[model samples]
Target: MPDNFGRYFVNAIVAGLVGRIIGVVKTEYERAKVETAAKLKGIGIGVGLLVAAAAIGFFLLGVLITAAILGLATVWPAWLAALTVGGAMLLIILILAGIGASMIKKNKDLTPQQSIDNIKAALPLVD
Candidate 1:
């Protein structure tokens, strides 16, 4: 009976140790997941900004081309046509800025800290 009790106690201790190790592993995995998600979100934001800037640049370029064509067709001074195109470009920039601001305001919920906390809470460690 004494030997059996000792063996059972040893088994219980080993089981508890295994459970603790598993909990640590799960916590670490959750942390890694949160970090990766944050990094991906940042990358997505960078790509979006780059694309938006490129689109705006292309739009301005088109406006300039159109102005040049108009100046040649109507015999207007090239300098005045260029100035008008510049003003139009400025107006487009302001409109884009307003759109960007509104979009940022709407997407304010996915903050970095909140994302981390939400992931941590979702991944509860088992003992």
Candidate 2:
């Protein structure tokens, strides 16, 4: 009977240790998943912001073109010249925007995940 009791006690102890190990592994996996998700979200947000900026730049160019055309039709001769100049300025802006977009696209290292990781690493060190 004493031998049987000892065996049962050892089994219980092993079972408890296994359960704790499983619990710890599950917790670590969950933490890693959360961190990965946050990094992805940050990358998505950065891409979205850059795209939005490009979109706004394009929309402004369209508006400027429409105004330039309308002004050339309705305004006096002097104003028509000014409107043409404004159109030229709009063309320059569009060219600059294209260059800016190209630069942004070429920048491979500036990702949202990198930003998120930097912020996370910095925060722990700050306090």
- Best lDDT among the predictions, by candidate number: 1
- Predictions in order: lDDT: 0.66, 0.61
Q: What value does the lDDT take at residue 18 in candidate 1?
A: 81
Alpha-carbon RMSD, each predicted model: 6.7, 9.1
Let me know the TM-score candidate 1 reaches against the reference structure: 0.53
Candidate 2 per-residue lDDT, tens place, 34-83, comes to 76566555556556655665666576666667667777778676556655
Clashing pairs in 2: none
Model 2 segments more than 4 A misplaced = 59-127
TM-scores for all candidates: the values are 0.53, 0.45
lDDT of 2 at 103: 52
> For model 1, which pairs clash?
none
lDDT of 1 by residue, 4-116 (tens): 99999999999987887667567766766676676666555655654675687777787777777777777767747675876777676666656655555545444455445
